[model samples]
Target: MADFTGASTGGVSTIVTDHAALISACAAGEKQALKTLMKAEGGRMLGVARRMLRRSDLAEDAVQDALVLVWRRAHQFDASRGSAKGWLYTILRNRCLTMLRQEDREVATEADQIEATSQEAVLTAAFDGLETTTGLRQCLERLDGATRQAILSSYVLGHSHGEIAGRLDAPLGTIKARVRRGLLKLRECLS
Candidate 1:
């Protein structure tokens, strides 16, 4: 079936030197340099924050704040210790670390190895904590059988639409429709 979302990711390339020129230009008070730097490194910084905070908007905000700080402090930059790219990375890292520390104060408990060691167990415990009937399972139960199965396969089993279709012996379009309908039904039920 067609994936109209146009979502595809791959071919990771790690470059430590991409931001050096932009940093140098920014340090020289070139506004164009700062703009170039933002365009060049924004995606990477966003990825870093997202991985650290597990939240998209917060990650974007963190990167934006870091870029602002970098622009304001560019004059004090020292090239002897590290490259400009490294300096930008340090700024983003510090911002994410600080945000994480502040967020830690509000959370009741930390979730360190819980995701790595016993993810299913953690999810089960969290789900069971819902004293109300609006838990994930109950909401899922309200969906059509095929749709619920498709959604469960994609979300819980971590399968793609094609994989779910293959496993369930259904057409890919059918699987995608089921998954979408299932998710909408679940959201409505929970709401």
Candidate 2:
């Protein structure tokens, strides 16, 4: 264990060294090596998984399964072929992609549908409850339909900017700008 703390310093060489040492130790059946690797990169790995899988539970499962594979296949890593960090992310990404493909085939159960409907109802109600005469409502009404829809789809409907962009058939950057400017306008109006 060569000071895992050095790995967090954001230097490329230090990260490579730490990951290489950890992976080598893992290949040698050192259980602590896997723990150290997880401690060092688990958050980033989970972030990547979450971005790919969307669902937190599924992202967690993907990260766990990727770690298991890393333990089993550590011996296959070749520093000459690529950096240790890249190798590790490659394994994690592969696991996430596999899980995503499997998820595509999964059908929503009745309970899942009910839960989603209730959640949507709650979100919709929050938006609907805004009194017509309130400053917020009046400010929202002042926005153009596209901008207003972008803001509501994100804040009220719980959609990702990317999802809203796709739904509106607009560029992602445009959708983001609409939301940002829309909020700024609302803030100015309320003030």
Candidate 2, residues 11-106, lDDT tens digits: the string is 554533478888999999999999989988888788767655656798899889999999999999998999999999889888876665456434
Off by over 4 Å in 1: 1-18, 104-191
TM-score, one value per model = 0.47, 0.51
**Model 1 lDDT at residue 43:** 81
Evaluated at residue 160, the lDDT of candidate 1 is 60
Candidate 1 weakest lDDT stretch, 10 residues? 1-10
**Candidate 1 lDDT, tens digit per residue, 1-191?**
11122223576443433456566667777887676677667786787676555567778989989988898888778878788778888888788767765765334134333233453443344445546565676886567666765665443333468756875798999778778777787788778
Clashes counted in candidate 2 amount to 0
Q: Give lDDT per model, in order.
A: 0.65, 0.75
